[model samples]
Target: MPDPVLLVLDTAPSPRLGRLTGRVDVRHADASSLAGLLPAADVLLVWDAASDAVRAAWPGPGRRPGWVHTAGVRVDRVLCPELAASDTVLTNARGVFERPVAEYVAGLVLAFAKDLPGAPELRGRARHREVQQVAGARAVVVGAGPVGREITRLLHGLGVRVALVGRTARRTIHGAADLDRLAARADWVIAAVPLTDATRGMFDRRFFGLLQPSARFISVGPVACVVRSGLQDALERRWFAGAALDVSEGEPPGPDGPSRDVPGLLLSPYPSGATVGWRDRLGEQFVALYEQWARGEPLPNVVDKERGYVPSADLPGGAGPDPGTGPRVNGSAAPPG
Candidate 1:
C-alpha cells in the first residue's frame, strides 16, 4: 500500500508539519485549493475549520478520503450535506484544546471577578480594596460539547455554580429555552457553543439586553454567535459590563470584525489555545491515532459529519484519557476516530 497521504487545509507553519513528512504524506491546501486536491489524500486535517471550501467543493464525482479530522473543535464551518452523509469517517482534536481553553476562561473569570484589570492604577495608591469571591458565583455555560464539559468541571472547581446548556434538555443540563433564565441570573455568561444555523447571530441586541447590567459575556466560540453591532452597542451603553472574545467571525477587526472602542472590553488575538506544550500535544494526538490506524483499529473522537463530531462512547468523561499518553486509545472498541 502507498504511504498514507494527509491533506492539511490551513496555514501551517513549515516547521510544525516537518514531523509528518517521514511517516505520512502531507500536503497543504487552503480553502481555494481544496476541491482540486482533496480526492488524492487519505485523510484531511481541517486546520481552518471555518473554511467553506470543503463544503463548496464536496460531492465530487468520486470517492473521498477515509477519514477527516479538524484542527479546531467546532465543526460548524466544515460540515455540509455531502460530507455528512458519506461513510468516510470524521474526527476532531477534541482533547487537544479543552484544558488550555478552560484555563483561559478561568483566567478571564478570575480577572473579571478579582478586578485584576484595574490593578495598574490601584498599585500606585496606598488605598486597599475588597477582593470578591469568584467562588459560588453563577456561571451559565452555553454548549455541552467536550469543551463545555471541561469548562464546567474547571468552573466547579473554582467554586462557581455552572449550568450546562446543550441542544437537548437533560437531567443535569438545561435546554435552549432555559438559557434566558440562566443568562438573566448569571454573574458570568460564557459562550462556548459550536456554530450551527440555530446559533448563528444568536447573541444579538435582545440577548445582550436580557442580561443584568452587571453581567459579563465572554465568547469562546465563533464570531457570528454574537452580532458585532449588538455587542458593540451593549458596551457603548454599558448594557453589560464587558466582553472577552477569543474567536470572531471577522478577525483582523476592520475586515467586518467587531470594530468597537468599547470600554471594559478585553480581547485577544485568538491566543486561547496557543500554549507552550500545544505543539507536542498535537503531535501526540496524531501519533496515537496513527498507531490505531496501523493496527487496523477504530479511532477516537470521530466526527459525525451530520452532527459534526462523534464523542467516543469509550471515554470515561467523553474525552478519552489524559493528554500525556496521546489520547488514551490503548483499549478495545478501536477508539473513536
Candidate 2:
C-alpha cells in the first residue's frame, strides 16, 4: 500500500513532522489552498486548530480523508454537517492541554485573590491594603472533563472549596441543576466546559445574576456574556466584582495597546494551553497517534463528533460510563454533546 497522504493545515512554526517525513506523504495547505488539496489526501492533521478553513472546505465534491485530527481540545470551529455525518473518524489532542490549562486557572485565582495586577500601582503609591483570602474560599467549577477535574484538584490543593458540575450527576459530581445555586454561594466561578448548545448560552443573564457580587468568573473556553462587549456591559453595570476571559468573540488588544479601560475585567490572549514547548508536546502526541493509525490500531482520544468533544466516558482508559447513563458510544447514548 502507498504511504498515507497526511495533509496538514499549516500554521506558523509548523508541526515538527520530521519524525514521519519518510514514513508518510506529508502535504501542506492553508485556508485558501485547503479546498483544492482535500480530495487526494487520506488523512488531515488540522494543525491550525483555530481556523474554520476545514469546515468551509470539507463539503466540496470529492473524496474526503478517512481521518481528521485537530491539535487542540475544542472542535467547534472545525465541525460541520458534512464532517459530522461522514464515516470519517475524528480525533483531538485532549490530554495534551488539561494540566497546563488547570495551572492557568490556578494562576488566575491567585491573581484575583491577591490583586496581583494592582500591586504595582499600589506599591508605586506606597499604599498598604488587605486582599481577600484564597484559602477557605468557595469555587464552583463547571464541566467534569479531565480539564475541569484537574482545575478542581489544584484549587482543592489551595484550600479552596469546590463543587464540580457536569452534564449529569455521577458519584461525586453535581449535575446542571445545581449550577445556579452553587454559583450563588461561590467566591469563584470557573468554566472549563465545552462549547455545545447546552453550554453555549448557559452563562447568560440569569447565570451571571446567580453569582455573588464578589465572585470572579473565569472561563478557559467560550462562555456566554463573557465576550468583549458583554464583559464591558457587565463591568459598566457593576454586575459582578471582576472577571478573567481567556477566550473572547473579538480580537484582543495588542501588547502595546491601550488598557481595556474597564476595571476588574482581565483579558488574556487564550494562552491556557500555551506553556513552553507545548506545541512540541502536541506534535509529539500527534506523531504517536499517527504511528498507531499507520499500524491500524484502535486510536485513543476519539471524538464523539455529534457531541462536539471527546466524551468523558470515551477518554483513553475512561470508566465505561456513569452508572445511570448507558455506555457512551459516539455520544449516541450520552447526554447532549
Best by lDDT: 2
Q: Give all candidate RMSDs, comma-separated.
A: 5.5, 4.8
Candidate 2: residue pairs that collide: 307-337
Residue lDDT tens for model 1, 1-337 = 7778888887654345565667788888887888888988888877665566777876554768888876667676678777877777877777888788888899999988788888887857666677678987888988766667677777877888888776666445667778888999998998887666677888899989989888999888777777988898888899888898884433556756666466877886566876787756766676677668757899888765554555433445444233442222222221101
When summed lDDT is taken over every stretch of 10 residues in candidate 1, the lowest stretch is 328-337
TM-score of each: 0.84, 0.88
lDDT at residue 173 of model 2 (Cα atoms):
73
lDDT for model 2 comes to: 0.77
* lDDT string, candidate 2, 149-210, tens digits: 77877787788888888777665677777778889999999988887766676666666777
Give the poorly placed runs of model 1, Cα more than 4 Å off. 13-23, 30-33, 48-52, 123-131, 248-250, 311-315, 318-337
lDDT of 2 at 321: 29
Q: Report residue 155 deviation for candidate 1 (angstroms).
A: 1.6
Alpha carbon deviation, residue 15, candidate 2 (Å): 4.8
